[model samples]
Target: MRSRLALPIALIAAVSVAATACQSSSGKSSSDAAAKDAPKAASSVADYNPQPYDNIKDGGTYTTAGTFDDQGNPFNVNATLTASRVWSWYNADAITYSPTGEVQYNPDYYSDVKVSVEGGHQKVVLTINPKAVFNDGTPIDWTAIEATWKANNGSDKAYSASTTAGYDGITSVEKGVDAKQAVITFKGVDASWSSLFTTFLHPKAATVDNFNQAYVKKAHPEWGAGPYTVGSWDEHSGNITFVRNPKWWGKKGKLDKRVYVNLESAAAVNAFKNGQLDYTSAVDAESLKQIKGLAGTEIRSGGSPFEYSLNFNTKSPILSEKAVRQAIQESVDRPQIAKIQFQGLDYKEPLPGSAVLHSFQKGYQDNVSAVLKYAPDEARKTLDAAGWKPGSDGVRVKDGKKLEVGYTLLGDDALGKATAGALTAMLKQIGVRLVIKKADDADFSKILSERNFDLFLSGNRSMDPFAARYLCDFYCSDHDSNITGSGTPELNKEITATTEIADLDAQNAAVNEVEQKALQEYAFLPLFSGPSTYGVKKGLANVGATIFYSPLPETIGWQK
Candidate 1:
């Protein structure tokens, strides 16, 4: 069996937060009781197990809520969460990450995978299953590996990959011991080799134009190779239906079909209440209220390896000063923000202290306690010391400039609005004006890609427990995802060093060092860490809120 890895942070942003209101039979709030009964923060992968795949009954269509309105090309960096979910359902990777964070070969895609260092060069060999073929009848082979490498290695400016972190280190990719094998060589030792190939594109669609625009408003089922295929997509109704793929070489999936319904959080909650959705992640108080006593529904909650924070654009004139950034970081009360955002949800989180590793993960440390403590007075003092004094309007002014910051809100969702409002009110206490900038719903991805804001509220969920997998793209100066523009040469060097470490323990130590420095410098503001809450149909097996294992389509079915 192939271990399913957690979805990337970008994909998690798409489906991690959909839920509806929950109320008891008597119309009373159930949040208080739920909160009291909530389990402790998860410490190991076993804490999040949903249900055994063998116990599920075969053949049923599972309907769920999705966050993206359209499913873009999975290969494109601009691909939405909905696209990723669909892609994962209809694709296989050469290797997969186990819920316990170990790298393992996918029996469905590869026969074997090995990594070694020869002559100071990192080498990876992947043996593909000769019988495996895409829905389009293209045999899975070295060509697909080469295409994935070229498209993501940063060697070609035309390919718009989500991130070039692991692929950028590759020196070459060639045929391995046989036609079904791929031997990839890297410039040096790279620890993120296993993290690549989560999604594969057909060799025919490897061109720059095809990668960037081919699947904009279209999905080609023929190119996908999973147990399920895209059966129909109703753009107007915001529903996508997936049926079993005839060309799939793996065992028949338990569910014959699955449907993803794009909905706003509120509508999703109502849909769940109306028995339209089998599962919905209820993150806010309102959504939690609506699903409390739904028949045959179970609420599953566990720590998520997701980090939500305020990303500061270091290039902004008003925020160029480290003091100003530090002041802003200290002024806003994270506990208060979490409180307001999760109000009535019966959930509260501890202050997060690391950008890379979550508190629930091993080697976790609170490195930002000194700098991140909530202190509006200290923030005012820091601004004053930095030569910013209060003006008649109560906003700080330095050199004839007011201390103002712009924040981009990606959607008009209630949670986002409440977060922005809370942040605006909190910043006002320390003479900082937070200007809320709402991005057009259709242009959200564009605004994010253009890095068009002073402070952007976003989060990334770690797909693997290895923090090194994210160091390059999250903080490296050359990466497109480093919106902060705060990457320093020293920081980059340290982060790069982690990729070269062969031992996991040493690599993690180096990661901790880098995270500490980044947090201390206020590279980004760490908010509280909390678990994702989900209301799942009681008998729906092999699926629920989890950070370790993704709910595999083949294993998802109705419980007998």
Candidate 2:
């Protein structure tokens, strides 16, 4: 999320790298994506400078950085935000959504939409624009749409689709009246029928062999069908370059070139200061001070979809015990962590309550507050009841084992280190020993994949506004993007049924109920949903910290 990761349609949204460690798309797919008509979060909740195409200059290169390439997979659940953002640049988009939840058909691809429910099964009809074509001159038609659905609908284990969320409900995808139209039929009444196909996969990539192997070492520009195409992918430099696509049928992309350079925190901030980067993250106070008021910079900020939190690994011997995990979670001071995190920034949010929805969003509930409160005495009692008694070193012991867990401290950021110190002190209050391990910021993705740490500070970012559907990713199991060992098969099965409830309010209530049950496990301790703040090289437009506004590839450029 913060560095490089695929942000899914829902984001697969990675918590911005600006948080503690690299956080990524914790939101994948769920049947209940809250509701389209639900109250929207205020625009003030986000602060991206809103500049339309008319306001942007026509020809300037815009550069940013991240860990990208996506292993060549178009929709890997673990894809980084940079990859998804880049994918948007080179792919045909069928839908356009606002920072709030309003949706519209982008006329570049889709011409009409018709909905119906026949014999209790929901069916949708979509017409692709006759003029639309892929970069290779293939007509953008129903076959491309069908290919995306079949690859992801869980029918074929062979295809490496991200998640089977909305796609799994589809019973069939057939050609409508002509090659330009698609007819989609779902198994039953589906609440989130419109949530699928915001973007498309070129039919060629959907083939079993190509779907799995096509994008590994190189990005196939000919398979892309958007404003920009992959120009270069330098493995040695970990840099990717994109140039305006000559084959694009839509309006020309404003920038002549786009690039994502992989850099760690210190170098990235330095790059921003040196004017090498058009956009840089400044989530912590130390980083914020660097670019806050440089002559050419403007601090663009808004409510982040990312939630920074302390995640507990249930597989660790010291943490596997539910009581120990519960007590450790209860003892931490979230507000204190917040105080340390936002020390200099003019940002404050209610301690994050749910992994599903941010506090500013409608249908959000303070689920964590009631379950894990700041109570040291009670946490001590919890340990006492579980046969953990204070010993000679004042650390709790259970059956001759010390009640200690290792925490991976990522990077040299002062705020990150300071919060670790606060965490150590809080654990001491309950007679638990917290061992700290130091690692370079670049080691974040490596450490997470190998499950190297017992305790970690990470964020779960969301890309779409209707996050209720992502509960399956957050709590169902640690199969895909979810790294915290916090799910059970029984709970996952229950969550699937709960998300499919047709009534909006009832489904949200059900989603919350399921999440509360999951949080009771104490795997992920929700800290706070911090601001997605960035330092922008002044004059940059249509890009900054906003929730659901994925820029129309051509619109992100220097202001005129």
Candidate 3:
């Protein structure tokens, strides 16, 4: 039998709640001194050893820094990155993909998963564990499966999902031979089937209204099924606490409590210096510098599956012409931008070539070098050939219109601001005026949702190793997340072809073809591919920086 642990789902909305209320009070001052005096340790970003359960010590509290406000609702389409991080602990998935792209199943939740294809249709059978149940005593069976499918399958307009790539292909979900088994049938062969079910909602809360509005400021811990329960939430301080669940049926988790504190990029580093944050990502140059000399801290760096890119709003008048978009793509110097962003850091990323596959992933091919080359001379020539002529002020003019574009700075992060400044200077050399429009983090989503920018710096993190999952989500014409508006019938057909191939090699080849075509059209400009860096408190094992692997909460504790 697989070990089971209970996890929390909601925040108890009280601003005055003390962090000590959830765990034994060590008193903040003494704990801070001890944290500063602890022995230092280090790990690499490529390392994926989750410490053996036997080596982990029991009964301790861990605190970490997060970027965004909690959404509470993981199923919501607009859920923040921090919410996703928190969900990894509180929610259970049938299967999960590792940082190195290994797929493993959670035996505590499902006994087995079988995949088969017949008559051009793919089917998946999931066998839920008999003893598994939500905190409210609801069986983790067909109702949950059906609700998950209905909410994410894209058949209904009411249900809002982050991405409908895999779920949209599902035709039906029916009960299998037993009450604990679920039989899912797809409309056609989908090689990305494993990507679905990373998150699920209860049947009662799967409705449109409940999924969106019900969890706005509330956390319904009753819907959670992990090893911890919602202890307290101090909204004013942006601290959330999770305590051990007495009803957990599996091996007792090592940590007595877990706390996630919301802090901005720079503030998070200061918190770590003050012995408040146990783990925090060192994303910018300044954060990396501040943590270098910190005692009892370890800096882990590696190549990340995430990449930043300049997304073009093809519908905008300034970027409507294909030649103009191609020119803008060729003008920007990705290497220089990478150098500036990661100046003092140990890791530096190479110019990214593919939008679908990162350089570290298998089957990655350099498709952008031929089309999106960084050559300002070539960019000027392309613009001149496309009826855009240099004006007296050195800005391009085409048929009484100026070749000016607006670049939206989503967050006031140092890396983004530096990139924008560099890009503004580079574009001017090619007779294109780039305007930097600053947008608050809170308003960034609204701007993207309304498609109100000509160009923006954005990125996508692969949920799975398979590149097919990203094809439709990022490039499909009708996808809600397709802000570029650059999809075509041929591109759509090529993307669909990748999903139909079951073999990994064949699917990768098909994806490369799609990427080449997309890059030729200048769909989106790929920047650098690098890993997320973090400063972790030494002795805290399996709780720091990671790429693909979501650390199991039960396995995270002080090293014995």
Top of the candidates by lDDT? 2
Which has the higher lDDT value, candidate number 1 or candidate number 3? 1
lDDT of 1 by residue, 119-152 (tens): 9998888888888898888898998989988988
Lowest summed-lDDT stretch of 10 residues in model 2?
22-31
Each prediction's whole-model lDDT (CA)? 0.70, 0.71, 0.69
Report clashes for each candidate as comma-separated counts: 11, 15, 12
Native-vs-model 3 lDDT? 0.69
Native-to-model Cα distance after best TM-score fit, residue 543 in candidate 2, in Å: 1.4
By TM-score rank, best first, the candidates go 1, 3, 2
RMSD of 2: 6.5
lDDT of candidate 2 over 111-152, digit per residue (tens):
898888888888999998888888888889999989888887
The order of the candidates by lDDT, greatest first, is 2, 1, 3
TM-score of each: 0.89, 0.87, 0.89
* Alpha-carbon RMSD, candidate 1: 5.7
Clash number for candidate 3:
12
Deviating ranges (above 4 Å) for candidate 3:
1-45, 67-72
